[model samples]
Target chain A: MKLRRIQAIAVKEALQIVRDPRSLMIALLVPLMQMVIFGYGVNLDIRHIPLCVLDHENGQQSRNLVARFAASNYFSLRRAAGSDREVAQALDEGDCGIALVIPADFSQRLNDGGRATVQALLDGTDSNTANIAAGYAKSVVAAFSAAAQLDAVQRRGGTLQTQTPVGVEARVWFNEALESRNFIVPGIVALVMAIVGAQLTSLTIAREWERGTMELLVSTPVQPMELMIGKLLPYFAVGLADAAICLGLAVFWFEVPFHGTVATLLFTSSLFLTVVLCIGYLVSVSIRSQVGASQVALLATMLPTTLLSGFSFPIEQMPAAVQAATFLVSARYYVEILKAVFLKGAGVVELAVPILCLALYAAVVVVLAARAFRKTLD
Target chain B: MTPSAPIVEAREVSKRFGALVAVDRLSFAVPPGEIFGLVGPDGAGKTTTMRMLAGVMRPDGGQIVADGVDVLAHPEQAKRHISYMPQRFGLYEDLTVDENIRFYADLFDVPRDVRETRAAAMLAASDMLPFRKRLAGQLSGGMKQKLGLTCALVHTPKVVLLDEPTTGVDPLSRREFWQILYGLRAEGVALVISTAYLDEAERCDRLALLHGGRMVHCDTPAGLKARMPGAMLEVVSPEPRRARDALAGQPGVRGVLLIGIGLHVHVDAAGRSAGIAAALAAAGVPVSEIAEVAPSIEDLFVALLDNAETPA
Candidate 1:
């Protein structure tokens, strides 16, 4: 491959990206837009669910129970119902996501040191939200039960130790608060790089075919290897720039933590960028029309990055077949590395498996992309 | 004359697409400082032939040598001396004219010092020097074809294969394009151009008449026209359509075409021309002039192909 030919191709591609409004928009603006959308908009964590309460007894115990639900950050008091019908109304009208119903004999039963059940009615239409809300409500009621048991023992003058006999203390790591933003922001970085990188490079070769420039271009002294290298050099730089933009926004704009070294982050990012660029180049080589190539590139890169890479959904949640397929999706490895580096403060040594996977993926695709191009039309 | 050797030679080159034979045993050679025309209408394997010579395609069953390099064996090496333009003017509409030329110059490894002067001269010759800064997309169809030519010639290739460069271009641009081609010939560049336009065929140093992927005749324009099977007589009458009708089924009258200013009548031989005139006069058509005329390239192609198709 001649370096001069490579430089020439790269320069011409750079001019085209600048001249085409569509390509320019994709390269320069898509990354930032995707980052903002995924970072600030998509949140997996369910919080601040509207809750309505039904009190059958006017006892202090029931009132105190309602107060506990209101004080917790997980639930906010939207309405206080005097009757069961009111609670049913609030749940049916979608005024509340969940309803807390207390029994009339609740205070008497709890005073007797017996089990008292408080029913939680949830909106099951949004099953994911409903399930998480149920879990939160269980924890809140559990905490409230523990405290009420202590109060009953002291009021009865029994000789009970103030300290609990057994307790489970949960200490969260990596993300101590379990903030979904910290988790989602890093994944968004990988996703944006995959989309913008693949999209921009997807049009590179296909545009030539559509515009009839491929005929003259293939007739030149440029080798297939030289043409592939020349075509990818400009896009490689653009991919890296997109990486910098998305990663910078993740750390500074969204306040996602950066626990890893800059060298490792940049190195791993470049590796992933190489893989995605090759994927786009391969799509361009296979499909001659620009629209067809762009769509196929999206299918090859964006779908895998967003769905199977554990970006929006967890890879482990997929079926066995699809989970195994995620290994072929290069974005899975990059997403793993980004999340580790951002939240866990993991370095290269700690994340060697994913980095190696990404590097191997990049090597294979580079070879494929280089072999895919020929200086012949047929 | 090419004193040393030809810059391009295609020998028994054949290509097939699935079950369709696009080109069969198509053999032609282009010497230096000569313009060789592959003359045929659409689907006569003109583009395929041009492609094989340009090293942009693989000829299924033959040998192609360009500048002494085996095109099929080492296409990339052969490409250094060849410039191929497709039927469509392959200019990047988004890029400026100067940028497009520079791109090709770079790809062909045109030296930094020589590239400037070469590009400038070609642009000036094509009268595109002033529009160098304009985007190629904004140029007229004729100008786009000229830009395609300029880019193709930027590398000073030994053999240039142009595939219908003026197919859709305006008449004015077509004339201007020929001027640039003659200049290339003056510079001793071997040019092989494919065109369906027979008028363009007469200007070439030699011509290949192709029909259905086969070269039926390969000769100079004068030579091909001389092979016309029968005499073509021009009848100048006020009512030419009626004159054509009157001579339709007359003895020895093969075909009659209503052309501008007259009717072109084909007969079995030159001896039948006088009989056709008499037939037209006897039919009471006012015949102003009835005389023999040489066949144009189109008429010759039709008659020659007809002659080859019929059983001798």
Candidate 2:
């Protein structure tokens, strides 16, 4: 309740951080580096897929189809071979992510007006990118088939017309370019906030408990609420700094647009940080051992933020049970807010639910922390 | 309207952890401005009892009234009256002396101007003023304990709960630490200190002897010593442990304890020391000397515990 007491504890905690260089590095530098690493590393928007080919039908028709694959930047010709083993080897070693094979009787079939099927092999380990690559490859092959039909019709001296009355066109909004860097950078920022806010407060408070400093603090007339608030403030600032670092790198180095107002992002980010810090404090207060507290915080915050938050994996695409579990994960809502504000340029009206979720998370965690901290000397 | 009350009172306090009983139905009271000591060996429930009184732990069954407030029902308000230093006293190792002091003052909600002046006086009083700017982590063990005490006392609480505050420090620092506690007592502060050192218990106005979650005895250290059931004889022998086994619970002998390489035998006051020595000699236990001596607090503790162990 008292501001001065809270300020004093916050200042002392901040001083401890400043005194330890390793903690500072983990708090500030690690988040920025993670943003950049994840920004480049996790790409959902597949492009320029290296596609090797085994074109046994080396006739004019096959050569034209190869040219068509080259024209579409989706598939780059990495190798042209007759050996199935060599192409298979390329796919196995991941040297090429996708491969295409044309049958030996490709030109003869086309001349006879028969349908010739081309086999497309793709690496399905990374299902998202692989799925996108397979779609693009199929579309390019379909274009080649249509062009062949047109050529045949022109040679017959006939005007060609098809009756397809209606069709649907899919347009991607917000990130028209579908840049992977744009979508993942905001999630990395959320992860960084979770790590910084939770890990620091959890370790520091639990260390105090282990070393017997908490007993000293408790014996004093300092109110429990004042002590709890004071402990959270410095880490909240650190969380803010981590957020700034993530946004800076995302905007400056990766060129991801922050289309929404900075105020909204910072406000929401602060609320999320408070939630994490309170969770950390609660863990520290109840556990009493530094190692146990740190482990709890790491497991509770980091794992959920990574796996259940829809940060890298889409929660919608997950199983029904997992979708239900994500409701309890505060990071899921924050990640949605971060992505929306950064990419979709969503305002308060659109982000109110996530914001309210964060506020509620902060309130619940803080209350639990205070409750756990109320104890006796003996 | 009422007469001055005792500074602290606990009635039938007991704490249980699963099946293990830590502090049995314990009851005690400390009059105003007096030093009350909880003296017991390891696992005697000294720390647990102190923690309950400090309002850090809830008793499974009991009432702890400190400074006219129920510790269990009104912990936050009770916390305002007592300063508790756990065994470690949890000092901020990385923070400077002045910073650690200021931190506790702030935590206690001490006013700003009062904190500055009080912190200065505490440092001066403890002779820690010279190292005000030095990090607590870098200070010697004794200095850290001093700093911890200063922080605990910064808010001027009515009662101070010190849980083995001098467990690990060197002898010189232990003396200095006790001196500080003495000074606090001089200021009309009620002191409840738990210690394993019997000599330190002698300094308290009254002492509570606890063992196996039970209060073996509660009185002044001297009174506890005087109540030793028999005359204590210092026995010099070649084998102290062997002599202890031979003299222990022998007819007319109440207890046998090892003090250094010598055994102290508590015997019936009217019994003959020479006769006991002769019996030891007959038993092939070599005895160099046997002389009657006053019972120490530890001697009394060993006697009381030995008596409690035997079928009465």
Q: How displaced is residue A129 in candidate 1, in Å?
A: 4.0
DockQ (Cα-based) per candidate? 0.78, 0.53
Candidate 2, residues A1-378, lDDT tens digits: the string is 778877888888889888988888888887877777777787776667888989987889988888888878777888886699999899889988888899989988988999898888888887876898889988888788888888888898978863236856888888887777788878887887787678878886677777767766665556768778877877777778888888888788888887899988888888888888888888888787889998998888889999999889889899999999998988998999989998989987899989988898888888888877764554
Interface RMSD of 2: 2.3
For model 1 the local lDDT of residue A270 reads: 89
Model 2 docking grade: medium
Best by TM-score: 1
TM-score for each candidate, following the candidate numbering:
0.93, 0.88
Going through the candidates in the order shown, the clash numbers are 0, 11
